[model samples]
Target: MRTTNFDFSPLFRSSIGFDRMLNALEAASRAETMDDWPPYNIAKTSDDDYRITMAVAGFSQDELDLTQNQNMLIVSGQKANAEDGEYLHHGIGGQAFQRRFELADHVKIMGASLVNGLLTIDLKRELPEEMKPHRIAISTDSALPESETKRIDTANQAA
Candidate 1:
C-alpha cells in the first residue's frame, strides 16, 4: 500500500481555528483508498441540499441500518439467514457491508428511504444566523475641522 504525506503546517500557521476541519480532511483522504462495494453517488440537488444514493440491490429495508453521531453518518446492511434450499447460481451480492460519510458543520440528515434496490439519503445544511455574512455599512463622510469652515459663515453669506 502506498503512503501519503501531507503538510498542514502552512494551514496551521495561517488559520486560527480550523483544527477539526483539517483533521476531517485527512481522515477522508485515508478513507478514499478503502473498498468501493455497493456503489454510491453524492449529488448536490441545490445550494444547501444534497443526496446520497447507494445501490443496495439484494438488501431490503429491514436489513439496513442508519445512524448519525456528531458529524458522522453510518449506513450498514446485513442479509438475513437463508433456508436449507441450495442455489445453483448466486450472482447477487448479499454480503454484509458498512459505509460512513463525514458531514460538515451544520449539515444534518433530512430523511432516508429505500426503494427498488436503491437507498437515497437526503442532507441539508442549515447555518445559524450568526454564522451568515452580513453587510457592514461604511462611513463615507470624512471628518473635517469645525473651525476651518463653520456653518455660520455659510449662513452669513446667504443673508
Candidate 2:
C-alpha cells in the first residue's frame, strides 16, 4: 500500500488577500518569541468585563505596577532586595519582569489587584451603541435635478 497526499497549492494560489494572511501569520510567529515569563491567564469575567492573572510569587504589591497607555497594557515588576537574608536553600522566583499585552481599540482597564501570589487585573470595555458601526439612511432624491446641477456647476466654475 502507498500513501497519497492532497496538494494545497490551488487553495493558496486562488485565495484573495493571501498576502494579508501571510503578514498576519508572520507577525503571530514573531510574537511567539517574546517572553511570556511568569505565565498568565486571561478570562472573561462578564459580558463587558475581563481579568488577567499572572503568577507573581515573590513580587510584592509595591514592586508591581500596571498601566494602560493607549492600546498597550504594561505590567512592570522589580524585585526590591537582592539579598534579603542568609538562606541555606532558596527556591523562589524573585526577578524583575515587564510584560506587555496589546489591547484592542476601545478596550480600557478598570482596575487591578495583587492577592495571595497572583496579580489580577480587571478590565471593562465600553460597548455603547454609538461605538458600533451602522449604516446611514440613504435619501430617495439623492441625485440632483438638471437645474440645480447646472447652478452648482456654474458656482464651481466661478470659484
Candidate 3:
C-alpha cells in the first residue's frame, strides 16, 4: 500500500488570515468527485453572466435543491423511483448526487431549470462598488516645502 500527504503550510502569509483561506481551499479540494457521477458544465453567457449545466436525466425539479452558503454554491439531488420499469439495459445514471461549486464574492444565482435531461443553472457576477477599481485625484498643494521637509527630518534625527 502507498500513502500521500497534502501540504497546507504554504498558504499562511502576512495578515491575510490564511486559516480562512485554507478552510475554503480544503473544502473545495475535498469536493472533487472521484467518480464522474453527474457530469456538469459551466459556461459564460455574457460579459457578467454565467451558466452551469448538469446532466440529471432521471431526477425531477422537486428532487433537487440549490443553496448558496458563504462563498460556495451547492446543488444536490435525490431520486425516488417515480416509476417501476424492467430494463434490458440500465445505462442511464439515476442515482442521487450532490455537486458543489465555489463562487467568488458577489456572484449571484439567477435561475435554474431542467430541460431535455439537462439541468441548467444561471449565475451573474455583481461587483460591489468598494471592490471595483476607481481613480484617485492628487492635490497639487499636497507637496510640502523643502524647508518644512528638512525641519521634519531634523526632528526625527534629534528624537
Index of the highest-lDDT prediction: 1
- Tell how far residue 33 is off in model 1, in angstroms: 2.8
Cα-based TM-score, every candidate: 0.77, 0.63, 0.72
Q: Is candidate 1 or candidate 3 better by lDDT?
A: 1
Ranked candidates (TM-score, high to low): 1, 3, 2
How are the candidates ranked when ordered by lDDT, highest leading? 1, 3, 2
Residues 1-159 of candidate 3 have per-residue lDDT tens digits of 343345566666444756766777666555543568798888998998999999898888898899999878998888886767678887988787878788876889989889988899999999998988999977564475666654335655853
Q: Which stretches of candidate 3 lie over 4 Å from their true place?
A: 1-6, 13-15, 27-33, 142-159
Q: Write down the lDDT of every candidate, Cα atoms only.
A: 0.89, 0.78, 0.80
What TM value does model 2 have?
A: 0.63
Better of 2 and 3 by lDDT: 3
How many steric overlaps does candidate 3 have? 0
Tens-digit lDDT string for candidate 2 (1-159): 443444544656778757554544455555545676788999998887889999998888999988888878999989877676798877776778899877766788887888898999988888778988899976565465666544335656854
Give model 2's clash tally. 0
Residue 75 local lDDT, model 2? 94
